[model samples]
Target: MESVVIFDSPGKGRGLKAAKEFWAGDVIFSEASIAAVVFDSLAERICHSCFRRQEKLQRCAQCKFAHYCDRTCQRAAWPEHKVECGAIKAYGKVPNENIRLVARVLWRLDKEGSMVSDMQLTTLDELEDHINDMQEHDLKELKVDVHNFLDYWPRTSKQHLIDDISHIFGVINCNGFSVSDQKGLQAVGVGLFPNLCLVNHDCWPNCTVILNHGNQSAVSTVFHSQQRIELRSLGKIAEGEELTVSYVDYLNLSEERRRLLKTQYYFDCTCEHCKNKTHDDVKMGGKEVDGVKPSDEQVKEATDYCFQMMDKMDKARLNGDYHEVSKICRDCIEKTEPILADTHIYLLRMWSTMSEVKAYLQNFEEAAEYARKMVDGYMKLYHPNNPALGMAAMRAGVTHWQAGLIEIGHGMICKAYAILMVTHGPTHPITKDLEAMRVQTEMELRMFKENEYVYYSMREAALKNKPMTMLHEPRSVEEGIKNLFHRK
Candidate 1:
């Protein structure tokens, strides 16, 4: 039987369809790719100034990782090396080639580099040709712009940096890293796999890809004779639809998503949300009875007005004007609502913004409800493993706690912690925050229990002070105090 097959998904984009219908949660295909080109732990011992993994390291004065055998190597590599040194220190590790691929692509695109000098049609053709020649594994690796670096391998010493980058891509193209669980977060490596990449863009996605890391180099594959890993539909998808996954947090606005997609992938999207012509030309409190044609100038004015409103909303958020932010977000939504439906990513963001606004206004119950709805919708699209899902879960928990729903708060917090622990591992910053919240909640529960006991004890003492005594002898105040202290 064929391992995988590609075909058109009904009304969705092109998708990898199953050659044979498989059961739910089946592994469609699994390929491992290297997670990191350079390990952070190893880099610390080596000269961070250059890509030399060393021991007995001498640290660079400019950055923490710029360790050198002596001042000579440091000085020698400084001109080409110093630029990335501080970045490495800030990130605390060198990113692998895959990450570099995305970074390089973005950097070059932003700088208008010659790499993508060709027009969009030509670039698309080149990409399609490259995909046609690739094996399943190669195709998967090629999905991310970073994996494209694999095609530029076999570099000469004259282009050492170029060669290094190419090799990094090649390594990550074949290997997958194991994420480490420290504290509450996971450590991620640069190599994002190709199969995962082909999962197209959705404002909401069904499955979430997680990273795993450890200190060993091992690769293993498990195949089932009776069952296969299946890409179960998160929502209904007709035959031949493009199976998509959200690359960014779907909780973000359409503008944010569009900007990221254009900057990262060099595509001008005409997605359902972006092509809302009617909504884009509408105004607040202005009525069009559906028969009047808007003038070109009117359309331009509406477009410019939307942009202006977005700019103002951004400024209001940055300036800490929660009230203005709330009002502006509402205005944007009210204006856009008649044109854009609820499924638009911007609408989802508006809901999130509304939740934030309500929270800021001390309307915890309403805020919590709105956050819960957002989380529910996000979970449907991205599943529980995505970081955005975890964040929504965390926010939902916080809102519940604020609203005095202790049981619900605990449940949400626990769920968030569990999801974050797997995706980010135990050592990630977000995981640490979740861990702290969990501990704090548990402590609060304990304190509440203690306070209840104290209240009961004091009430009993007050009743006894009224000279009411049972047939049995009553305990003295000293004895009672001792007993209460010793109960635990």
Candidate 2:
């Protein structure tokens, strides 16, 4: 429990504070989840083409396992299934629910395995042990639904599937469960781990964790890294403070947010925002009116004003209002800055937006500077291979090119292209954009060199035709050309 209490961040209804002082840029925690799934077992029982389970189904010729109802469903699913078929066949047995859940969690960890480490796996093992010690009622309740779900399936010729699946459930019972009729909600994927999950919730969390689709894997990636994988403070934490993170989007209304956190995370938030709405209401009132206490309508107006301002900022660039875009973006930064720290995602967006606007306004130098900051912010929030980071790198490269720094521009663009190629692949629109920019930059550099050569030749001709003067500024045509070329 003490290990889980890594930070003290007080706000909204819950706070996340540092259990120990963490240096900047450390990977506080990382867990993997499943990114993709092939419900082959489910497919075996359903139409592969329509993804609708049925008692009888026909198998596709390409991969004999893909059961389809008709040619239409088969044709529709061909694009997605073609590539996945080989991999699915290779996986051999469909993993048991527990193994499947674990695999799913692992898949959620980004495709890049940079944040993963041996220590995280050990922590997962510890969680398994802890769950095993739960009350008998809890264990029974958790497993009953899962066992029943398996019962519905026709008995497979392979008994190993049932045995393997049962073994997985045994592991899950040791952890925890939320059961429904069709499936048992295992604790492994529910965002719980004594040390990792102990970190409290915040409306404005300093860090974020993305659970891969299907809840197979999770990675708690810092939006910023000042240090390596050491536990650090989100803000300031007292010795005994309970560290929290905003499990849901804090930008939503407090009531809605509280309900989500409670329902999903099982914590009743008493964070500052929920506790002191009066103070927040008053502060909001001050934004709209002089010092007068705002009426309910006035409060709503003020809230709407801030929300609309943010919305306007979001669309300003699309609408082609550069000046308003910049102004509104900056205004948002100013207003949100106090409530949301620099590491907040919203703040990072504001910084990036400002950088983009600067670039569009032809302030290349400033744009480049802001672009660097945006890159840093993105790197902190996302893994190195994230498309957003690649996009930011491309923007920075463009700014460098605009400022007449050819080498740096080329390097930045090349880096952007490389990363984009990996994350989104060559055919992605962004990858194509970066590739086009690279070509354009190369062409401009070649033309610039050619222009330099032409200018030098003209200068040489002028020097050669000049007559001798008292100042000793005279030369033959050949000498003049040589001198001008030499000077260049």
Candidate 3:
């Protein structure tokens, strides 16, 4: 907040602008969550205080709902949980993430007495709800949530009018940021950071938002660090330049991106890419095969088929049927590869899914191959310093290393490190891990080059008694799919 000033952005509403020049990787600002809650579905898995996922968590004995990693985390979350514990028990079930979030915000507002502080740029009342812009179906769903929220609200607590409650829900719908886990991989919750909401969207943005789960060794620090976020410059920005981050994934074709933005955020994108349909050709490129080129109509037909396949794939994924998801991806790729270019969005999606599923199934060589293809397409489609590109490259690099392609693994890890240094900064846990990986891969490459025979002999001997599943965990595959599909 100190590094940037809130100002009226042209075309866009209010935006955060740089107060001074910022070099690539410089942190523009960092803010802790005003109010946050883990998704109910993940309540048991993720610590309520630190937002870290664990295999075993200590359940709050009193509430019998909230979970934490240790007494330290439990103590840290008590302030937030204290208000809702009795209400949740009386209500007989934990409300969904949305209702719980709304409750958290209300309780916090009651305690704080004011929504905006002296240094705050906007008040909670000032944040747009876009309720009027919501479609009929969405409004109906919101109404249901409001009803549930009212039922879940405790009678002794301060009450709010239905209109005000509904407005808060709309505001959250329009402004909430997806909070990621400690590794900046899987999304675990949703949070509201007021200053972050002031930033505007751009197809080609100059800033990236990272959910920073702080140092874990220091329990007190981790407690204080829950749901914190840092906004970093994607590249150089001069004084007074507006800081923007993409609300939607910019790698999608311009039309699809705009459609998503308009549908979700209630804004028509008029960014340069949207205005000019820039990179649409490359996104939707098609090629001829066996002296037969797909006509426009054929490509359109294939694209439609791919969309249907994607829906099925999504359902299978959500159902936790990785085998079915892999089958769908392979079938779609076989049908669309000839008619659609390898760079097509649908093709890339399939390649990404195939890679993760293959990795999950322990087919490392095939996983590495598909991951490499997905990373190559991402390189062509995303900004050179895009965080997503860096993440994908890191995944590909790890898959390659697991598959025993040392030279290629070293190269990809180095590439990922360079990109992440710009997008995630060197201090981020993911970037730090990538740096460690790069060092390991580099050493392995040198060893392999010096004596390929000796290197293989030693490596084989070392791994002979080790479990085949030890190279990569299934969670990594889960993280890959979650990161690609979920927003943050």
TM-score of each: 0.42, 0.34, 0.91
Query: Where does candidate 2 stray beyond 4 Å?
Result: 1-195, 204-232, 236-240, 286-488
Best by TM-score: 3
Query: lDDT of candidate 3 vs native?
Result: 0.82
Query: lDDT (CA) for every model shown?
Result: 0.47, 0.46, 0.82
Q: How far off is residue 385 in model 3, in Å?
A: 1.1
The C-alpha local distance difference test score for the whole of candidate 2 amounts to: 0.46
Is candidate 1 or 2 superior in lDDT?
Answer: 1
Q: How displaced is residue 99 in candidate 3, in Å?
A: 1.7
For candidate 3, what is the TM-score? 0.91
Model 2 earns a TM-score of: 0.34
